[model samples]
Target: MDKVLLKYAEYNEPHESCTNTDIVDILNKKHSAMKPAASGSSEDTEMMGD
Candidate 1:
């Protein structure tokens, strides 16, 4: 999870309106949606080798 999300979850811990699980679920969905494309350029792969 991201630091901002983690902080938000922590802040919500004392509130009755939101739960940690809810925050986690939202974070998961956000992360999946923000995932990078599977295909990488040749330059990207070459940099990985170094």
Candidate 2:
């Protein structure tokens, strides 16, 4: 999501604050280090068996 958001931001040019795209891009890119939810679920979890 962050990646998509950042892509949009870059496509639209710079801004004073990070746009939704930038925020989403950063979050998605940093997903691994971010905390898991209370249910301990994460995007990576779905791919574990692969």
Residue 25, model 1: lDDT of: 96
Task: Please list the residue runs of candidate 1 whose C-alpha ends up more than 4 Å from where it truly belongs after superposition.
Answer: 1-16, 36-50
Against the true structure, whose TM-score is highest?
Answer: 1
Please give the lDDT score for candidate 1.
0.73
**Model 1: number of backbone collisions:** 0
**lDDT score, candidate 1, position 41:** 63
In order, candidate lDDTs are 0.73, 0.70
lDDT minimum window of 10 residues, candidate 2: 34-43
> What TM-score would every model get versus the actual structure?
0.40, 0.31
lDDT of 2 at 13: 60
lDDT of 1 by residue, 12-39 (tens): 4565566899999999988776665433
State the lDDT at 36 in candidate 1.
Answer: 56
Q: How big is the RMSD of model 1? A: 10.6
Candidate 1 residue-wise lDDT at 43: 58
Clash pairs of candidate 1?
none
